[model samples]
Target: MIILTGVGDVKTAIESLKHGAHDFILKPVNVEELLIAAERALERRELLIERREYQVTLERRVEEATRDLDAAYTKLQDTYRATLEALGSALDTRDVGTQSHSRRVHGYSLSIARTHGVPGHQLEDLEQGVLLHDIGKIGIPDAILLKPGPLTPEEWKIMRTHPEIGKRLIERIPFLRGAVPVVWCHHERWDGTGYPRGLRREAIPLAARIFAVADAFDAMTFDRPYSRAISFAAARTEIHRCAATHFDPAVVATFLSIPESLFEDIRRRSLEP
Candidate 1:
């Protein structure tokens, strides 16, 4: 932007500079000065361009890292889902007559959770909680768990530990930690008479409250050794009667709001391979 002219005109030099000229060379240009000014301008432009390029590259790297993290997290969630399914299937094999109880309850609980606006990872956690709620029974003595007769008061004490046991077993598992509340509190009654912690009413987590209703209905309508299978309608009636006492009244109301056909469909699916 330097203006090289024959005259040593101060006014012209000032005008050239006002119009963005970097320097004004006199009639006989100082070759060294011209070279230095041009070099300095190029250096400043190069630095600015390099800085902008670095910023763009840095932004791209950060975006890529975010995408990678999200993909890895999604993969982790899928692995946990598979592991939990295997555990539920294992329970079916280990316990006689439970065949699809875990799966059924998982389906039922997921339905209820969705109705209450719970979704995504929270829904997944609730499913795991309900499916593995009885996993602690695995630790109970065969004499107590497999006993055909009613458990004695002492035996009941041992049976009750399953919730705590279940909680302890999976406490170390990162994926199952969100499920611990349901696993520990599912057996707690609305009236606070239920086992382990005796937590009542709102003291119970909503996930567990939702689960209790699903578990009861599934147990009654499904075939098991201790009871003959009852009709789904009959199971609904029994649950409705127990509302606010054995189950959360709000949860029962919501549970009943779901179409009976949906419950029937879930039951039918549970029967499939």
Candidate 2:
């Protein structure tokens, strides 16, 4: 940073500065002036070192703060999921003979969605949607939700309202709004015969379309008061039969592509006795 130059060489001094020389002196330098210049340069260097250290300390603090913020957000996300799961599980409490339905359907929905290329946090959103999908059934009387057989026409009308109710309820929570489609439209049919919005084809969100297949598969394979459980192959057959009618054809195809072992393993875990 220190340089020797002619006292009259202003141009050379400027050039040296342009080239990153911090200080310079004349060739016929006074010893005192030269010592002063050297002392000033050393002081400047120390100041620069201090400044760099301060910047490093500031950067480290910022990084620590960012990491803490990320961790807090992660914990908040976990709490959100746990709360939704609890609410979803409460649905099973209202109905008898079917415990862990929400968890089962969540697992099934996740599997189907992943097979359809829904990756990362979108998959988590779908999981949230699955857990909270049945939340609006809280408004329905147990008489309708737990009916051992088919619901009456009047009961069916009320039953269909659950999707809209769920949509309204969940959109109130900003973070959960991303999952509204699965909660509200999972029952939609590919042919537009579904209730509520009756969205057809690509109009339905892929998450909901994927959920429809998962929900149906779980429904058919699991025991209900009106019917006994069916084999995985039988459920798969039913899903294929309804493709493009009750379910998305692409989603159905994806569901079929999944190995039976994956489903069997999920089913084997945490089934209610």
Candidate 3:
């Protein structure tokens, strides 16, 4: 339907533009011209509305896709972290006597790394390495690992294979490859006397070196079947004594400088049985 209105020449044209009217005729009107203009105006309005709707729909879809991508990314991160924790737990469970050993080693290693000013990324690697350091023990025969007495020469040979076993196990998992060196070499000594390659001094990976100190400290201070747990003071002395032999001298020095109270607290927390 075509509608036309005019108060005067100028006002009539202004009103048509402002109100988006179909058409306006002068005092002498032409019905045919008005009808044509009305049809064209309505068609243009429909096209504009459709274009706006299309744009809005496109934006909505883009937002939804972005949300989906974000959700997937979050799930991936959660899965990776859970998998790491589970692997650590699995290794721990394999050794019934060492129930919370992995967790304690992780905490102690990070603490030592922090005290020694290890770099951020390196510290993270150290933590992961320490948590899974003994994972290779899983491959060893239960008789050797759970023996009531000291291992015989042949049993010791079999037991010493764990580092390689652990390294191989972790290397197969892509995310854990960075931690394999530490897992493989944590048993190595600073003076070139330890096993699984006998990598010594600076030749050993720094993460492994750091973990070695933390692992030994925990081992010495914790009660085992063959020995009683030592005092923090004794543990400190032993760490210092082994500085240049079993442990990196600099790392041991740094560890000694850490307050005794800290080690005591860690020991207490770890004993939450």
Model 1: per-residue Cα lDDT over 140-198, one tens digit each:
98788778777899999888999999999989888678889888998999999997899
lDDT of 3: 0.81
What lDDT does each candidate get? 0.87, 0.86, 0.81
Tell me which residue pairs clash in candidate 1: none
TM-score of each: 0.80, 0.92, 0.71
Candidate 3: stretches off by over 4 Å: 1-79, 271-273
lDDT of 2 at 10: 78
Worst 10 residues of 3 by lDDT: 1-10
Mind giving the per-residue lDDT tens digits that candidate 2 earns over 1-273? 788876657788888889967688877878998888888888988999999999999999999999999999999988978888888888777876557778888888888887788888789888888888887887888788888888999999999999988899889988889889898998888999997987889999988998888888888888878878999999999989998899888888988999999988888774755
How well does candidate 1 match the true structure in TM-score terms? Answer: 0.80
lDDT of 2 at 176: 86
With a 3 Å backbone cut-off (N, CA, C), the pairs that clash in candidate 2 are: none
lDDT of 2 at 179: 82
- For all the candidates, what are their Cα RMSDs to the real structure? 4.5, 2.0, 7.0
lDDT of 1 at 177: 88
lDDT of 1: 0.87
**Residue 239 in model 3: shift from native, Å?**
0.3
